[model samples]
Target: MLTYVCFLVIISVSGGNAAIHSLMYTYLATSGIEDVPEFMTVGFLDGVPLVYYDSNIYRVIPRQKWMNMAVESDYWDKETQISIRFQELYKININTAKERFNQTEGVHTYQVMYGCEWDDETNDTNGFHQEGFDGVDLLSLDLKEMRFISLVPEGIPTQNKWNNDSAWLENLRFYFSDLCIGWLKKYLQYGWSSLKKTVSPQVFLLQKDPSSPVTCQATGFYPIGVTITWLKNGQNHHKDVVLGELLPNEDGTFQKSSTLTVAPYELKKNNYSCVVEHQSKTFTEHLTEDEIRAIHENYLPNSTIVGVVAAVLLLVIICCTAYMVYQKKIESESCSDTTRRPKETNPSVLFLGETMLLAF
Candidate 1:
C-alpha cells in the first residue's frame, strides 16, 4: 500500500510569511506467488496518484484527435520509462523478501516504501524509507543504528556501508528532498490555481457474507483529509474497526471505507452510526434495525426464488425420466407377448388335403 500526505502551509521564511507546500510520496509494491498479484503504486498526499496505476501496470489514457499527438506520445513514453524502472526495483525487493522469509514457494509478499516531506518555506525536510517482507519491517533508516538496518534470515545486520559514510547518506537525503520540493513547486506554479472542489460522500453499508464484517464505504469525496469511523452508542469504537486506505476516483476525487464487526444482539440493542468528517462538515448515517432487516429480507427472496426454480427443474427431469422408463417397459412386454403366441394353419388348405386323401 502506498500512502502519503500533502498540505499547503503558511510558514515564515526569510522574515516573511509564505505559502509553503508540504508534500510526500510513498512508493509501495507487493508481490506474492498466489493470492496477491504484483502491484505498485506511487502515492502523493493522502494516496492520490500523480499517475494512475492498476492491474500490475499503469492505465494509459488516449489523447483526443484535436490534441498534439507528438507531445502526448512523448508524455506516455516518459511514463513508460518510469514504470519500467519501478518494475525492476520491485523485482529486486521481492527477491530479497523471498530470501528473508525463507519462502521458496507458496504465498509471500514484499513491499518497498519511500517517503519524503519537504517544506520549501522553512527549508525543512525529512526522509523516510523502509522495506517490508511478509508483513515484517526488515530494512529502514534507524537513528540509533546510525545507518540502515537490515533484518535478514540469519541475523540482524546493524553495520552497513553507509554507517561509515554519513556524508553520503546526507547527500542521498538532500537529493530526494530537493526532487520532491521541485515537483511540488512546479505543481503549485502551473498545475492547479484554485482550491479543490468539495464533494459530499455517498455512503453505503454492505455485508458481502454473513460471517464477514459489515463495511461502510464513502465514495466521491474530495480534498482528501476525510475521516470515516464507526460509532457505537455515540462513541467511537476502535477495537473491532478496520480503516481502509484512501483511493483516488476517476474524476480526481477520493474514496475510503471502514468496516466494523458487531454482534447481532449488540447491534440491535445499541445505536450504531457511520460518521464522516470532510471539509469542516460532518455527516452521520445511522444503522437501523429496519435497514438490517431489509437487507436480509431482500436477500432471502432472491435466494428463495433460485431454490424454487431449481426444485421445479429437478421435478420435471425426474418425471420425464420415469415416463421414458415406463414406455420402455411396456414395449418389452408387447414384444414378449407376440413371440409367445402359437401359429395357426389355413382352414381351406386342410379341407383340400382331406378331400384328396378320401378320393384316393
Candidate 2:
C-alpha cells in the first residue's frame, strides 16, 4: 500500500426558522512532490445559487457569476481553472445536499461547519465529508470511489459499482482510511483539551409569570456536560423538573436551563433550590420564600407593561389634541361674537346733529 499525507477541510452553514443547513468538504494531499491542494465548497439554502470554491479563491463565489465572468474577463480563466478541475467534486456536493436536505424545502434550522485534517506518510489523500439535520448525518462521500453516499435518518439508494473495482480498493487502502483515522485522532485530542478547560457558570433563577414554571438558567460554562436539578427541602424533585439542551454561547462556551413547577401552596411552604453538577464540581442555590415573592412583586410582565405604557401615551396624545382643538374652537367663537355684536349707538353724534339743525 502506498503511504501518503492528506488534509481535509469541511465548512458548514446552518439556519434557523425554515432555513436550510449546508455542509461541504475539501481534501488535500501534501506528501508527494507533485501534490497539489484540492478544495471544494457547497451550500444549501432556499433560492440561493449553488456554491463551490477551490484553492484559487478563499471566499465563496456564486456559480452564475463565475459562469458569466468566465467568458468576459481574463481573470476568470485563472479563477475558474481550479473549479473546472473539480467540477465532479462540486456536483457531488450539490447532489449530496439535495438528497440530504430535500432540496432545502421546509427547513427550520441550518449550520455551517469547517473541518481540516492532515496525514503524514505515500502522499495519498482522502476527504471524509458529511451533512445532516438535527444532529443526524444525512449524506457523505466515498472518496476512493468518488461517489456520493447516504447516512442515517434518511437513506438514499446507491447502485455505485466502483467500490468493487480493484483500483478503487487500492486507493481506499492507501488513502481513505489513514486520512479518516488521522482526522478522528485530531478531533479527539482537541475535544479532550476542551474538556480539561473549565469556566464557572453564572446561574440565575427567574420567573416570568406566576402561572409559568420557575427557571434556573446556567450560562457561560465550558465543556457543555452539565446538569441542573431542582431540589425541595434538600430532596431531589424529579417529577417537576424540565431540563433544556446545552446551547452554545457566542464566546464558545455553553448555556443551559432547567425549570421547576410547583403549586402556589408548595412554593410558600417549602424552600426550593437549584443544584448544578459539572466537571466534578457541585453548586447549590437556594430560593427563599421572600426572594420568590420579591421576584414576583418587583417584576412586571413585559407584555403588560408595554401595553400599559402604550395606552397611556396614546391617551395623553389624544387628550392634548382634544385640548388644542377646544382652544381653537373657543378662539373662533370669541372672534365671531365680537364681529356680530351691534356697535353701541353714537348718542353724542345724534345730539350734535340735532343741535346743528336747531342753530341753522
Candidate 3:
C-alpha cells in the first residue's frame, strides 16, 4: 500500500511538472529564437500557471532550485528573462447585452502567461543548472515581472448590480471580469457612455420663508459615477451642506443625493445652481429661495382639513337632534291646554243653537 501511494504521488508531481514545462515550451517556440534553454522553470502566479523556458540549457530547472533562485537577491538581476503576455481564452460580447437582466453575474476570466528566457547568457545552461553551478528558478521571478492584471470591464458589471431589486444585476457582475485587458477597457468605456445618457439628476430645496433661508438637496447619477454639489454664488457650499446616502443602481451605475442648508436670501439674490453631471454633459437647474419655497408650500395636506370638516358635521347632527326633542315636548303641552277648554267650547255651541231657533 505504501509503495502504491508513493507511485501515485510521483505521477501527480510529474504530471504537474510536465504541464508547466509544456506551457514554457509553447511560449519559447512562438518566439522563434534560440538563445533560451531547452529546460523550463514553471509555477503558478496569482492562480495562473507560468512556464519559463530557457534555451541555453536543455534540461528544465529542478523545482527546488527554481524556488531558491527566485528568492535569492544575487540571481534577481542575472536570471533568464523574456517578455510575458496574458492569454484570455473566453470573452463576453458586449453587444449581446440583455435589455433587462435575469441575473447580475459578473464574468471572471483567467489570464495565463508563459514566459521564455532568451538572453545570451551561455554559461547559465538556459534553465538547467549543472551540479556545481548556482541554481535558479526562472518562474518565481520578482513580483514586478510576474503579477496579475485584472481585465474586468467597467460597465459590464454595471451599477445595475448594486441597486434595489437588482439581484439579477448583482449576480451578473462576477462573470464580467473574465474578459481580456484590451476588451475590458473598451467595454468599460461603452458602459460608462450608456450610463451617462440615461441617468437623470434632480434638485430638491426646502425653504424657511419666502426669501430667507433655503435648504437644498442635490443628486446626480451616471453610468460611470455620480456626484452632488451645492453652489452658492458660484462657490461650493460643502461646510454647511448635508450629504445623503449615495445609492447605486442595477446597471453598475450610481445615485447620489445630498442637502445643503444655506441662507435663502443669499441663494435667491445670487446665482444659485444645482448641477448634475453625466459622462457627456452637465444638467443644471437654477432657482431662487422664494421660487423654491412657493413650490413646496403650494402642496397642502388636504387630509387634515377633511378630518376637521367631518368632526364639525358630526357635532351639528347632535345639536339638531337635541333641539327636535325640545320642540316635540312643547307641542305635547299645547294639546293638553286644548283638551281642558272643551267645556267652554260646548256652552258657546248651545247658545248659538238657541239663537237659531228664535230666528226660525
**RMSD of each predicted structure:** 32.8, 34.2, 46.7
Off by over 4 Å in 3: 1-200, 206-220, 250-253, 264-271, 294-360
Candidate 2 structure quality by residue, lDDT tens digits, 188-234: 33333333456777776777666567878777766556889888898
- State the lDDT at 8 in candidate 1: 13
Q: What is the alpha-carbon lDDT for the whole of candidate 1?
A: 0.44
- How far is 115's C-alpha from truth in model 1 (Å)? 3.4
lDDT of 1 at 270: 90
Q: Report the lDDT of model 1 for residue 184.
A: 47
Q: Write the per-residue lDDT of candidate 3 for residues 234-275, one digit (tens) a residue.
A: 877566666543332322223454555556456546787666
- State the lDDT at 257 in candidate 1: 81
The parts of candidate 2 lying over 4 Å away from their true place are 1-105, 108-176, 180-195, 292-360
- Please report, in order, the local distance difference test score of every candidate based on alpha carbons: 0.44, 0.40, 0.28
C-alpha lDDT of residue 184 in model 3: 22
TM-score of 1: 0.55
Worst 10 residues of 2 by lDDT: 324-333
Question: What lDDT is reached at residue 322 by model 1?
Answer: 14
Model 1 clashing residue pairs (backbone) = none
Q: Candidate 1 — which residues are off by over 4 angstroms?
A: 1-31, 35-39, 52-75, 142-147, 151-171, 191-195, 205-216, 227-250, 257-274, 288-360
- Model 2, global lDDT: 0.40
Clashes of each: 0, 19, 45
lDDT of 2 at 144: 52
